[model samples]
Target: MSHRPKVIAGVALAALLAGCGEQAATAPSPAASAAAPTSSAAPSAPATPVAAPDLEADPETVATGLDVPWGLAFLPDGTALLAERDTARVLRVRPGARPEQVLTVPGVEARGEGGLLGLAVSPGYEQDRWVYAYYTAAQDNRIVRFRLDGGGAPEVIFDGIAKAGNHNGGRIAFGPDGMLYAGTGDAARTATSQDRDSPNGKILRLTPDGDPAPGNPVAGSPVYSLGHRNVQGLAWDARGRLFATEFGQNRLDEVNQIDPGANYGWPEVEGTGGGSDYKDPLVTWPTDQASPSGAAIVGDTMYVAGLRGERLWAVPLGGGAPRAHFTGEYGRLRTVEVAPDGALWLTTSNTDGRGDLREGDDRVLRFPAG
Candidate 1:
């Protein structure tokens, strides 16, 4: 894909605002210290596999025979849309039926951890029949919108996001305010995470037309917050608190309560430290147990997907820090989304060139939360 001039413009803008001081740094609580390692060589025990919780027992497979399925979104009428990263295909799946390819998008740069990654149904999907996606094009990772016409071409709504092979964050969701929100990565440039002017490492809030949403933290820009490395998952709880899952640099992975305009430390800090300006993560896990990807919130609990950790983490959340309930059940959990029937739908990433692949390497699993 050709490099769009807008991407360079965005980078220039980011460089101008990269001088902001780090903010809101608090020491990680003792609980957080116990969950995550303090240094790179900290001796930590391997995560033990636990029995499938009763709520997750009898998880019926929704789809099979897929290649690196990354994200899933359900239509208003109950059909599902899934994105296959390497294949560059968007599939429409009906219950108990074969998945049909809706469209094969072009301009995908399937390199390393980058590819077609996240998908979301438009907030007005019942009327518009539009689906939004985040993918790595040849030049950059971008978010685009398309109509879900089976076997037809997808109309590109927007393009020119920052892209990198490893930290190409690609999770998108429509927030409660009827606006689209995208989580972006820093494209291997750590300073970009702290650059408020850049869209690369921020939570972007935009209208359906891809314009900046009203009352954004940055006037005339879609950025809601700054200082993020690679945010891959976004979800809202019943209480309307937004949460995001982040990939840590080396030692710590995090789940944070996303506050608008907040600064989350990236290059300056890893797990937790004291600086008084950067916001500390509410929960941190060792990178080995929680290279988290996607997340879903049901009731007071948050279900997070782990890529390298090879587990599905159940975190109970209310106000204080989140607590881990279960770890290491399904290997390499990739995506977790709330289903219409109230069950949490999850996908695996073992076949995504990251880990060992067993029989039924990549399949969708459902866990009904009681």
Candidate 2:
């Protein structure tokens, strides 16, 4: 199957915005999608997985006037640090205030889905005041850290990953275990994804200092897993199990339980190959409906931000049938984060050159999360 651009999602919703240009009404329930998988495909049956929480309340617009916001991370003080992909600017937003530009990164390439992407506050942020970012540079994709005060230059902690016009993974987060985890795309090079020596197309585990984490899948190698086309989201459940959302080539999109040293077939097989060596996705969706981006886990449920699909997905931690919400209601969902106040914060990506732009082309929305 060829990769067709599913442009209907974001464009259709632009005409439905309120007078203030916000999505004020509750979205209709999603139609049953055949792409959703059942529990039988999961790694294991979860023991008493938590039920889905309520998000029935109308989502509130938290911030507006964003230019293709791509990443969201909250501070201890409840301020949101947002990243704009093409702008290479990080904005700090309060719950009821406009977003303020806090930091601007230098040397960003910002071309074709590659730019200043994922942002993560250091685990010891209160003391260290460090905020990490994954972005595309002129030569390769890299990760850098900067202080919150904006006084000093960005410290390049990691670099030399391959770069291209597309498929630059660019999602970074500090794991529960205190290691920095990064998801990288294949740079449109299929061979690089399968190459252990190449950093592209792999989930990387690193120390705060950018060295490979101890006890990694391979000695002295930063790669924690291999064989990915474009892994844009990474989250951890209460049990510290890692989950990731992947963009497939043409046929499928995936949510996989990531394991150390595991190989998820890319350029070889997709969806389910029934191979023991390659791990299968816990859930697979049609490529048109689920170009999943960012993910967050709250309690025993995981929420994925769907881009092409234009929806939010709730999946059980123990692996089961997934549910969809706000389908086509908020066009081109970019990032979904569990906010400090226990709300689900999401950003729209209609302004990212792929969707129809409205009066408020991109905005931050808050949904009640139990």
Candidate 3:
């Protein structure tokens, strides 16, 4: 069947989807999503996956008057934490409510494209209550975990990734296997992407307690995949396939299917056709239409937030060209995520010093993806 943007997942499923990153107020929590997958390496969803939600053309404004908001992870209560890219502040956000500053992360050095970036709630949050963040520190990019009420310094889980005025890849998420995954930039140093020993320009996988994941392709190292320019988005399909959105050179932007130890040809290639040594991107967009950042997969379709393109692209996993939605409506889209209630939460990045700023330059929007 051809892909359509609209499909009903029912009201009950809608409520369930609205809490993708947050805890459910009534019953099980998002941490349940982190429960050890049956397969320590790969966990594919059942054959009969539920129908994916549709993406509504119009959207609802959730919150306003914010700086450049980047990382977004929801709480168990269906609320979310918003990371301000420049201010290094974390805020609690929900619809129809004013966003309140929750904490100011220290050691966040907001350079050109750095500062506080991605956020992820612990899948085992009920017991651990840990929140993870990726940000630019004084000397390098780092990943840290902390608790809202723990009243202590954040624990640096992973550090020593390169930092730069730009290309400090800072998107992170937990996979179905319950391991933490991070995308790092080459920090403008093209060689780092091809060097297996370098942490930059690669996707790193780690255990929840700051150790390298046991099943990583490289033993004793967090490097899961290598040879990426700058990966800003990571998501999994219903069948446990991992996809990542990347920022390329002026020539092309790409979305690649991530494989353990796979090489995506950065300094060697841009879009595709890198002989047999590198994996080609599943989808490629012009730099103007993509500069893709955060993405959220609902069923078979992946919705990605575009930065320079100023639009949202809905891609079909079964195979097809991506369709753009809300193009130019929300300036400089930063992040897009699926909510437990089956809606899509998108953040605008016009205030991030690169786009045209409007009344509410940087804001959060809710799309009816139910």
**Which prediction has the highest lDDT against the true structure?**
3
Best candidate according to TM-score: 3
TM-score of each: 0.84, 0.85, 0.87
Instruction: State in Å the error of residue 41, model 3.
Output: 1.7
Query: lDDT of all predictions, in order shown?
Result: 0.72, 0.78, 0.80
What value does the lDDT take at residue 182 in candidate 2? 94
For model 2, the run of ten residues with the poorest summed lDDT = 20-29
How many clashing pairs does model 1 include? 9
Model 1, 1-370: lDDT tens digits are 2222122234434333322232222222434322322212222231211222335367878887789999799888767899999999999876588788988877788998889889999878888877888899877787777786643555555566678778888999987777888898889988888765567888777777777777664456677766888999998765456779999988888887676666777878875662566667867888987888999877656778888887777776633444443355556788988777666678887787766786776888766545
Per residue, candidate 3 scores C-alpha lDDT tens digits across 1-370 of 1111111123322222111122221122223333332324654552322345455556778889889999999887889999999999999999888998889999999989999999999988888999999999998898999999956988888888889998999999988778899999999999998776678998888888767788665457677777899999999877787889999898888887676666788899887777666666777888998799999988777888999999999887665557898799777999988876777889999998789988976889887745
TM-score of candidate 1 against the unseen true structure: 0.84
Cα-based lDDT at residue 23, candidate 3: 23
lDDT of 2 by residue, 250-360 (tens): 888888777676677787877776365566677788878879999988876779999999999887654456789989887999998887667788899999888877677
Model 1 spans with C-alpha error above 4 angstroms? 1-56, 150-153, 319-329
Question: For each candidate, how many residue pairs have backbone atoms clashing (under 3 Å)?
Answer: 9, 1, 18
